[model samples]
Structures are given as C-alpha cells and as structure tokens.
Target: MKVVPLGDKLVVKRLESAEKTAGGILLPDAAREQPQQGRVLSVGDGLMLPDGTRAPHEVNEGDRVVFSSYSGAEVTIDEEKLLILNADDILAIVR
Candidate 1:
C-alpha cells in the first residue's frame, strides 16, 4: 500500500526497540519503551508559503529521523503499524 502525506505531515515506520539491556539482561516486552526513532517512509510535498512558494523538507524517504515521544498519530496500514506526524514534530534527521 502506498501512503502519501498531505501538507507538512510525514509518514514514518517505527524502529523496533531493544529486547535486552546494555548488560545483556533480557527485558520483558512490557518493560520496553516506545522508540522515538523511525525511518521516513514518505514526506509531504512541503508547507505552502505566503508567496506561493513551497518550503522543501530536509528529510527524505529512508532517512532515519528522531521525533518527539508524544508526537504523531498511530495508524495501521496493511496490517503494519506506522506513524503520521507533522514536520514540526520531527526533532532531527539522524546521520
């Protein structure tokens, strides 16, 4: 399925969290925290400007990105979980 975000929204695929601690201690699923990082699946065309020029996004598809923990709306597409967030909610583009 193809999803195209409108306006300044972005579509992201969440990265799986670690199943163990740094010391190799196994952690239960319930103890795992939601990851704030994800891969950009799709980006909106860009925000419209007053002068009719669109502001391009710095991130592109397949780019690793970090966003606010509370940002985005959870959605399921083709039985796969994904996130839809605004561009402003993105914190940084991981290198």
Candidate 2:
C-alpha cells in the first residue's frame, strides 16, 4: 500500500529499537522503548499557505529524522506500522 500525505504532513517509518543494552544484556519486547527516529518514507508537497502557495519542507524521502516523542499518529497499513506527523514535529535529520 502507498501513502500520500497532504498539507505538510509526513509519512514516516519508525526505526527499530535496539534489542540489547550497552552492557550486552538482551532486552525483551515489552522492555524496549518506542523509537522516536525514523526514515522519511514519503513526504508531502508542503504546507498550504493562506496566500495560495505551499511552503517547502526541509526533510525529504530517504532522509532519517528524529521527531518529538509524543507527536504523530501511529497507523498500520498492510501489517506495516507507520507514523503520520507534521513537518514541524521533526527535530532533526540524522546524518
């Protein structure tokens, strides 16, 4: 399934959390924390402006990004989990 975000909205695929700790201790699924980082799967055209123009987005497809912890809505498409969030919610792009 393909997803297209509209009006500054972004479609992100959350990166997988680490399975083991720094000490080499394996962590269970229940003990793992939800990752706030993800890859830019799909990007919206831009934010709709009142004057009738769309604002450009800084993030692009294939760019890894970090977003707010509590931002974005989680959705499941074709058994794959994804997140839809505003461009403003993105903190930084991973190098």
Candidate 3:
C-alpha cells in the first residue's frame, strides 16, 4: 500500500541500531536501545500558517534524520514498522 502523509506530517522508517559495543561485544535485542534515527519515506506538503500561506519543508523524502526518543507515533504499515512525526519533531537531518 502507498502512504502519503498529510499536513506537515512525515512518514519515516527507523534505521537499524548498533548490535555491538565499541569494544566489539555483541549486545542482545533486550539490551539495545530504540533507534532515534530514521529515513524519510513520505512527507506532507507543508504547515498551514495563519495567513493561509504554506511553509515549505526543510527535509525531503530519502533524507536521513534524527529525532527525539519519543517524537513520533509508531505504526505498522505493510508489515513494516513506521513512524509518523510532525515537522517540528524532527531534530536534524544527517549529512
């Protein structure tokens, strides 16, 4: 199924988190933290302003971004986990 976010929302898919420590010690799933980084999948047009003008988004689809730990709402789409976040919730775009 195809997903198209609406009204300043973004559809993002989380990237894989590290499975090993810096010292090469492998960590089990129970010991791993939820990933805060994700790739932009779909984006809304823009936010509506009081003047009825739409603000352009800074990020685009395919951009890798970082968000707060509890930023977005999680959902399962097409049997894959995805996140829906507001544009303001996205902290940074990874270069």
Q: What is the C-alpha lDDT of each candidate?
A: 0.95, 0.96, 0.95
**Residues 1-95, candidate 2, lDDT per residue (tens digit)?**
78999989999999999999999999999999999999999999998889999999999999999999999999999999999999999999999
| lDDT tens digits, residue span 1-95, model 1 | 89999988999999999999999999899999999999999999899999998899989999999999989999999999999999999999999
Q: lDDT for model 1, please.
A: 0.95
TM-scores for candidates 1 onward, in order = 0.95, 0.97, 0.94
Better model by TM-score, 2 or 3? 2
Residue 70 displacement (Å), model 2: 1.2
Q: Write the per-residue lDDT of candidate 3 for residues 20-62, one digit (tens) a residue.
A: 9999999999999999999999999899999998999999999
Worst 10 residues of 2 by lDDT: 40-49
Residue 36's lDDT within candidate 3 is 95
Model 1 regions more than 4 Å off = none
Q: Local error of candidate 3 at 33, Å?
A: 0.7
For every candidate structure, what is the RMSD over all alpha carbons to the true structure, in angstroms? 0.9, 0.7, 0.9
Q: Tell me the number of clashing residue pairs for each predicted model.
A: 0, 0, 0
Q: Who wins the TM-score comparison? A: 2
TM-score of structure candidate 2: 0.97
